[model samples]
Target chain A: MSENLPFLVIAAPLFGALVASLVGWARPRYCYAIAMVSLAAGLTAAIALLVKVSGTVSGYEYRLGGWPPPIGIQHWVDPLSALILVVITAVAFLAVMSARANLQLELPGKERFVYPLMLLMVTGLSGMTLTGDAFNLYVLLEITSLSSYALVAIGRGRAAASCLNYIIMGTIGASFYLLGVGYLYLKTGSLNMIDLRQIMIAGDMHGSQTVITGFILITVGFWIKMGLYPLHGWLPNAYSFAPHAASNLMAPLMTKVSVYVSLRMMLSVFTPDFLAVHALWAQTALLVATIAIIAGSLIAYSQTDVKKLLCYLVVAEVGYMAGGMWLMNRAGITGTIYHIAADAFMTCCLFLGASGLIASTGSRHIRSFRGATRRMPWTFAAFLVGGLSMIGVPPTCGFFSKWFLIQGAIEGGAWHFVAALIFSSLINALIFFRIIELAYFKDVEHEDDVSHPPQVQRNEAPWGIRIPLFITSVVIVLLGVFSPRVINWIERFVDSVGVT
Target chain B: MSDVLTFIISRFNYWIYIVLMMIGLYAMIAKRNYVKKFIGMSIFQTAIILFYVSTGVKSGATIPILEHGHDIGHAAAAINPDHYANPLPHVLMLTAIVVGVATLGVALAVVQKVHDQYETIEEPEILFKLGQE
Candidate 1:
């Protein structure tokens, strides 16, 4: 049973999707309950798997259908994958906790399809995290992308247009990934990641032009999927226009998982030795990451819509993780892995709270947050916690990730990356402070509030939204307090992978 | 010049696939019509499928299926190393084809919705209307 946890984590959602789509047509109301139950089951399996993996020097691999590697596909849940699997399921659960409210207001009668699509998307995401086969990863990536395309299309007012753009960009990205895998297959005749790694090392294929081209193609594919910098044209509109419930889950998981895939490609499939052989590639990637950070931060600073602002912030967070991963040092890998977990939760909490505020304030503009602290104090507080985390304040998970990232840059002598991190943090501080001021103060044009007694309205978001937001905020702080333990786990994984 | 001709002729499949891919990419990027863009996407995906399928081809290889059917030991002893073309790429591309179709379906549906809402499927027109709204 313990060995089967990897398959079970994915199976729970796949089974739920089947059941929901089947029964939901007749009884649409039960779809939400089914989705919740399945996600909860997945979360449970993921946590158990994490616990099991944490006790081991190396993690377990469950061969599918009792078949061996290079031929049979397997579920490889190393400590790294197990940790990320837990984050994916946990974030999905939290995001779905508030879906009941969001969907009722937004779609009204479309719970059945939405729930199943969300479940399938989760299935694909978790499957992508768990699979050891490169081809299997591509299939699962399509499953995720296809379902998300539909989910994004479910949004109101210009969503379909954005969803079309997303589909076009996403298809190109996924196709490039397939082409890369095909190139590798032509070279090695094996689709399994571990087998591919072994074969490449044995065959001395690192310097081979085909293998190098495959690596670059694969990296660019994931960069597009992850919306890194110039290739991120499809992201902001697609995410901001999607339904809140969908965006909350997609925004955090999609890019982070893509980052994880690239990292997995580097550590597991391609090896650090290969990365060293191509030092120029890593330097170029880091430079692009630096530009991504500066550009994403500046664009985020310019957004008037709160949702769009968060979306741009997500773009910048991807830069942070991408830069950290490319730093090619132990501290950098640790920071990247830790930031994966931290940013997922931070983005989840922020998006959840922002959706709640948008619902309550009846506007998407930043100015709609005026006097929000008096109206929905709990939601504002939760959002503020997320904002501070974004700014990398101490005692939040964000700060620890940034600390490791900067330490890595200093160690690697990449002063530009360190400067970019500091610059992005300062910009984040400015963005959040501006919002905080708007939320805490009355409008400046109507400055009669200083002399008169202000009436504080207690119009808070429902418990559905507040509870998840509160839970995520608490998790952010707890993760921060327990950073050393998480960092230890990450460092162990990095060391085991021979990154240093 | 003869050597370059031999090189191009020997890898003509790859060259054709690259050409098709570039054409598809151009249409996807430059075309204003949604349907044309999607057609380009299909062609782009088909080019990749062609590439993958082409990789499975061997000069004198037959189909991957064994002539001995169920006699594994006998077949293993009798079969030559290069007797069969690889079947995995075709199998993988079957999945890719299904994914391509599903993506096309979703893309078309979104285009229909866009047409319904804005009464146009042209990119610039949609942008102009969205800007107005």
Candidate 2:
């Protein structure tokens, strides 16, 4: 039963999707309940698997149909994957918890199909995290991308064009990944990650041109998926134009899950020793990552729309994680893994709160946040907490991850990354403070307010919106205080995978 | 000269795939029309499919189906590794092809919507309309 947890986590959502399609149109009310219950179950199973993996000596691996590697699809739940799986499930659950209210408002007639699309997306992400087969990963990635494309298009307005752009870039990304996977299969005659790793280790194929080409192709594919800088053109428009419910989920999990895939490629598919032989790529990647941080921040600073600003910040966050991964040390890997969860919860909390505010305020521009603290106090509080976390304040999850990321840069002697991280944090400070000023200061009744305080009404968003925002904000802070323990587990996993 | 010609001719599919891929990429990036871009996307995906299928061929091999009842072990015949073309790439390409079709369906649907809203699928005109907003 314990060994089956991985399959169960994915199966729950897949079943939910089936049920959703069957009953969603006729009994649309039940669709939300179904999605919530299924995602909750997936979250529980993921937590259980994480606990089981932590308690055991070795991580759990379930071989489908009792066949061995390269033939059977294997569910590999190492601590690293378990961590990411848990984050994805938890974020999916939180997004579902907050989706009901926003979905009704943002996508009025589309409620029937939303549940199944969201469920399918969750299942695809869970499958991507669990699968040990490279080809299986690609299949799951398409499942995720295809569902998201439909989900994005479900809304009115510019959503169709946004979804189309996402589909185009996403398909090309998936195609490149398939080509790379094909090349790897041709070189090694195995599609399973572990078997391919063993073959490379045995045959020392690291020096082979085919292997190198596969590496380059796969990295480019994932970078596109990761939305790292130049390849991030589709993200801002696509995510911001989608329904807030969709944006709330897509904003956090999409790139972070792709980062996990990239990590797997770097650590499991190609050993760290072999990566050193290709240091030039890592170095170039880090340089570009630094540029991404600065450029993303500068561009985000210029955005009038709150959602678009947050989208650009996500690109910068990707730069941070990618830079940490390229540092290629234990501290960096630990930071990168820890940041994956940290960033997800923080981003989810912020987006959930922002959507709530948008619903209440009836505007998308930053100017709409004027007096946000007055009308939506709890939602504003969630924003504030999540904002502080984004700014890397102490006792928030973001700070610890940034701390280790900076530590990694210092250790690796990469002053450029350190400078970029600090500069981006400063830019983050400016971005958040600007919102704060607008939300708090601009709404005050002029010079008379100093003498007489004006009453500000609290027309808070519903509990559905408030509860998830509260939970995610609490998660951000809790994960911060417990960062040491989290980092320990991640470090152990990193070492076990020979990342150091 | 004959050897060089043979070498080039043997891998003609790969060269064609490269050419098609380049054309598709250029269209996807530079074309102003959404329909043309979708065509480019289709061509891009097909080129990759072609590339994958071409990788599966062996010079003198038959299809990968097993010739049963003529067991090499029982007949004591020499078995060459390349006697059958690799089937894995073909199998994977089937999945890719399905994905391609699904993507195309969604792309066309979105294009329809785009056309309905703007009355044109040209990106520049769309951008002009968007700027008005």
Candidate 3:
């Protein structure tokens, strides 16, 4: 079972996506069932792999077709990969479930195509997490990119244009990544990330100009995909204009996956030793991360649309993770890994809650949330939880992740990063609290005559959407409580990589 | 400096690759039309493919297929090793080409959808409509 886990993880989703696409033409409802079962199986396999590999210090690498090393494609289920796989599968499953009603509401006619495209996107993200070959990663990245374009275009008017812009930027990013891979192949003549790492360690290619250029190119490409500041121009409109279901699904997971890819490249392919030898790269990452934190927060605070605000917040969170990676310490990497899971839950909860708000009130603007607590108390409560989590309030998962990240910064003697973290948190609080205040405190205006008072209806979002948001909110708090164990697992994995 | 210039001249494909890359990137950033942007993206991606293919080039190499009684090592001894292009980049570029085409198809479909919704392909016009909403 353990040996076949790699094939199961990739094949289940690929086959399910094919079936869903085919059957969707005849019976659209079957698409949801197919996608759910496929992702559930994937989640089970990922968990089993994580459990089996947890006790072992050395990571497990499964090569397809029994091919070895530099020649064949491989799937490596290391601690980091397993952690990311769990997050990807979990968020994907919950998002697909939440997407059912949201899709019906926003994209009634295109429902048949949405499920299959979403499944393909899941398959692509799964492939990215599992693959060890750099070129294979490029192929899978394109798979996700293509599906995401289709999904984003399903929104009402002008969404298709936003999707087009996404495709353009996504292609440029992927092309840069491929160019970087070409340069790496030129220097080392290998595509397997582990093989490339070994070659760099054995050879004097660490300081080579070509390798440095490759690093810069690849990092830039990932920065674009991860929506790092300045390159984040494509995200707000893409997330805002996309259908509610599509935005909820892609907005939380897409950039996080790209960030995972960047972290994997930084940690696994170019190890700490390489970065240590070249401290200038670390300095560059630190500087960009600081700017991203500041820019993402300020921009998020200025947005009126709920989805756009969350999109900018995603940018800020990416900076936090990038800052963690730049710290290059055990604490920092652990914090980075933990935050990946925490942020996924927090972002999903917020987006799911936003879906509810949009459904109930038919409004996406923050100001339109007036007196939501008095009308749809459940949704307002869910939003309050999600908003609190976003603000990094205690007893929520967000606070714990930020705690580790700030500690890591202080430990690394990067006090400026510590200051930036505090500033970002304060801004996050302000952004979310303003929304909460509107939802709770705003006076309701009666448009009807004085004789007929406007009656407050206690209509909640449908069970399908509300259930997922509630579950994710619970997970956010649970994750905070169980953070120590997760941190321990990350530390063990980092140690296995021979990093202190 | 002359030796460096000689080496660089011998590897003139890299210079061409760089030029093509710059052109693609410039078009992608400067162009406002959606289809033209995708065209730029395609050109940009193809430039990377060219870079990869060039990396495999040798001064006098042939294909890397092994004949009977001749392994990779023995075949290398028989032919001038510098003449045979590296096959790895070729293999990698095959995958890149497929990915590029897939991305292009999706991008074009998205442009078609944009035309259906907004009846305009210009970026500024689309933004104007969006802001009006």
Task: Please list the residue runs of candidate 1 whose C-alpha ends up more than 4 Å from where it truly belongs after superposition.
Answer: A443-446, B71-74
Q: Which candidate achieves the best lDDT against the true structure?
A: 1
Let me know the DockQ for model 1. 0.94
- Measured on C-alpha atoms, candidate 2 has an lDDT of 0.89
Interface RMSD of each: 0.6, 1.1, 1.2
- Model 1 residue A228 distance off true place after TM-score fit, in angstroms: 0.3
Regarding TM-score, does 1 or 2 come out ahead?
A: 1
DockQ class, candidate 3: high
DockQ of each: 0.94, 0.74, 0.80
Candidate 1: tens digits of C-alpha lDDT, residues B68-106: 668686557677758888888899889999999998988
lDDT of 2 at A361: 77
TM-score of 1: 0.99
Q: What TM-score, over all chains together, does every model reach?
A: 0.99, 0.97, 0.95
Interface RMSD (one decimal) of model 1: 0.6
Fnat of every candidate, listed in order: 1.00, 0.77, 1.00
User: Which regions of candidate 2 deviate over 4 angstroms?
Assistant: A444-449, B1-7, B67-81
- Model 3 per-residue lDDT tens digits across residues A1-500: 67988778878778888898889889888888998899899889888888878866756889899898678889998888888888888888888889888977877767678888888898899899989999899999988988888888878876877777788788888888888887888888888999999898899788998888898889999989988888988888888888888888888788888988998898889888878888777777888898899889998899998888888998898899888888988788888888888998889999999898888778888877877877778877876787888788988888888888998888888887788789999998898778778776663566334565567777678788999888888888888888888888788777866565
| Model 3 misplaced stretches (Cα beyond 4 Å) | A446-455, B1-7, B67-83
How many backbone collisions does model 1 have? Answer: 0
lDDT by residue (tens digit), candidate 3, B15-127: 88888888888878898887888888888888888888887777667887655634465555566556566787888788788888878888888788878777888888887
